[model samples]
Target: MSYTVALFRSILFWIAFFVMSSISSIGGVIALPISHRGTIFFVRIWAQAHRIFCRFLLGQTIVVEGEMPDIPVLYVFKHESAFETVEQPMLFKHPAVFAKEELFSIPVWGQAARFYGLIPVDRDGGGKAMRAMLGAAKAALAAGRPLVLFAEGTRVPHGEAPQLRPGFAGMYRLLGIPVIPVAVNSGLAFPPRRWVKWPGTITYRIGETIPAGLPREEAEARVRVAINALNPPEALLESN
Candidate 1:
């Protein structure tokens, strides 16, 4: 698609997104007082609507490889763009995603996210923050919700692979659960911080599950490699 056409489509999609999110956020907050499940219904609706808008408005398609585990485990994803962030709700069944603490402070949306069981991480809060995150994670697991984390800490540009943030190993070690690493090329189609999105397929490549209890170094090494599998060869070389 031409740049102008793509830009137009992207603008339309964002307008729709804003309207949908506003309604969903309000609905989620109102539903929280009634029932937790009611809030989730709105969340799912918002996510599903975005998926539809992506396909029809932006001509973007999402494709996933490898089976998604049915059991609750730590799902580590390659963070490239906001696309995957929106995709998480539809991809996982009631996952408790680890999000930056700031996101949990976003008024109505933040309240709904907390109610939806997202764990907030304070990057500079040190041990106290880690302990709080772990407690929240444990509670989510006890409630049968799978843990979802973007181990890179922040979104890296497409094709660049960075080491997993320190907190990932800490969470893995303390949680004592298997890890499933997911790699996606969402940035190719949905570039971060950009208004124009191209029409293409975003692929999610699910790596083999790494069992829990491995030494921290070994586990992080394995995850780092797995989550970068989809990155271009030159990008991998650059990171190395």
Candidate 2:
């Protein structure tokens, strides 16, 4: 598609996305008082609606390279764009995603996110923050929810593979659960901090599960490699 056409489509998609998100957030907040399940129901509907918009309006298709697990485990994904952030509900069943603390401060959206089971991460909060996050994660697991974390901490440009953040290893050591590393090329189609998106295939490559209880160094090494599997060879080399 030409730049002009793609830009037009992106605008329309974003408008629809904004409307869907507003309705979903309000609905989730309203439903939270009655039942937590109702909040999740709204989130799943929002995710599915976003997928529909991407497919039909934006002409973008998502392809999963490996089978998604049914059990509850820590899912560490390559953070490339907002695509994967919003795709969680559609990709996993009632996932408790780890998001930046600032996101949990948004007014209506934050309330909905908390009700929907998104764990907040304070990057500079040290041990106290870690304890809080672990507590939330444990509760989510106890409730039979899969944990989703972006090990890179934040979104990176396409083809760039950064080292996993310290919190990941902390969670792995404390939680004692297997980790599933997911690599996605979403930034190719949905660039970060941009107004326009291109029509193309976005691939999610699920890597082998890294069992818990390994030495911190060994676990981080394995996750780093697995999450960057879809990145270009040069990008991995540069990261090293």
Candidate 3:
């Protein structure tokens, strides 16, 4: 009976998700003729609903401990689950995110992201895409929108992280803004293992906002330190 109920709930959640997504898409289309800010507001609402839907689908909840920065600045979010990509903005006010270029080609969805100020990337270390990310960061800084980046270039497997990518260091160096280092235990909530189905809580640990004007290498190192302070490998298993 529990299994049957879970299946029924999943079906209900998916139906609602499709309906809400269509409404969000319609909101974007309606905003095409209006102000960009309107579109951003619409997108934010859509993103919140989407995250809520994710919780419903997987029986998960996100708890972001600690206060976010009050000033407009750069936000360094740990990339683990797909949640960061969709729900990061909900945690920041008018945040500008760096994303892979392929995401920008996802039909109407991509267009809405572009409208909401997503910066797409090439992913080959650094080139025009890197420059574009820096440029977007600068614009966000100038316009007082928070800039968010993933230190990991791609999603690392649960309980296994390789190393911080170079682009994260490069962007921190060029931006010259304070970095609010955030660590997420999304993998515990949604394990990275293949075909895993259990659901749990995702805890977001927002560490002390590190002053971001440090040298390129130092800034990157500082971000890593803050992330590690949240959870070590030993504690990760208990969370899972």
Candidate 4:
């Protein structure tokens, strides 16, 4: 039964993916670059649509444990499932991610990403991407937009422990915004890699913000501690 259900969700997800990609691609090419509002609207719609799809199509539920702050914060979410594209904006209402420039090469979605004031980086571009994230995040905070960065650049399969990029820790020195560390165990329940998955509750735990304007090391340590606290006894992830 789970296999049948997972397959059904996968089918629906693929269709949605293509449809969303087509819309974003078409939109991206037509405009070349959209305004920040355009980016926010795209993400808002995409997030909302995913929430609906998850509940109706995937049989998933999310519970919020801590208070989601009103101010534009830096939300450091756990990278477990590809489903985060849905979770970030829907749960927090403020979704400004530090994404890859490759995404901007897509279509309307990419254009929207540019307009939404998202930070686009290049992995091959050395420290360039990290620099963009710092600057973009500050700009967004100034404009009253919360920043969302998945410390781990890409989504990892279930049981694959979260491996974080080094730059995320630097935000402690650069951005004076609140830090909301999130711990989600979606990989264990709705394993996207598997054709058949169990029907289980998806945990989305959000921690309080790390103190702002601390010295670089302190800030970095604070953020590290916050994330590490997400999974007690689990050590800071080693670089791959």
TM-score of each: 0.98, 0.97, 0.84, 0.79
lDDT of 2 by residue, 108-190 (tens): 99999987889999989988998999999999999888999998988899999888888898899899999999988899899
- lDDT string for model 3 (24-66, tens) is 7678767877878777877788778877876867687878788
Which residue ranges in model 2 land beyond 4 Å of their true spot? none
Candidate 4 shows a clash count of 9
Error of 4 at 83 (Å): 1.3
* Runs with alpha carbons beyond 4 Å of true place in candidate 4: 24-39, 126-131, 158-163, 192-198, 213-225, 228-240
lDDT of 3 at 79: 71
Off by over 4 Å in 1: none
Worst 10-residue lDDT window for candidate 2 reads: 65-74
Candidate 4's residue-wise lDDT over 1-240, tens digit each?
A: 557767877678657756775665455344445454455556666667766666677677776667767568888877767676556667655557777779878645666567656688676776776776677778778877777877777776544445457667677556766677877667765665664444567776767668677666666555555544534353454421
Residue pairs with backbone overlap in model 4: 24-107, 24-108, 24-109, 25-107, 25-108, 27-108, 28-107, 28-108, 36-115
- Model 3 lDDT at residue 134: 79
Q: Which candidate is the best by lDDT?
A: 2
Candidate that beats the other on lDDT, 1 or 4, i.e. the better one: 1
Model 3 regions lying over 4 Å from their true place: 1-11, 55-57, 192-197, 234-240
The sequence of per-residue lDDT tens digits that candidate 1 reaches over residues 1-240 is 899999999999999999999999999999998999988889989999999999999999888899877568999999989989987789876889999999988989999999988899999998888889999999988887889999999988888988889899999999999999999888899998888898999999999999999999999988988898888877767887
Per-residue error for 240 in candidate 2, Å, reads 1.2
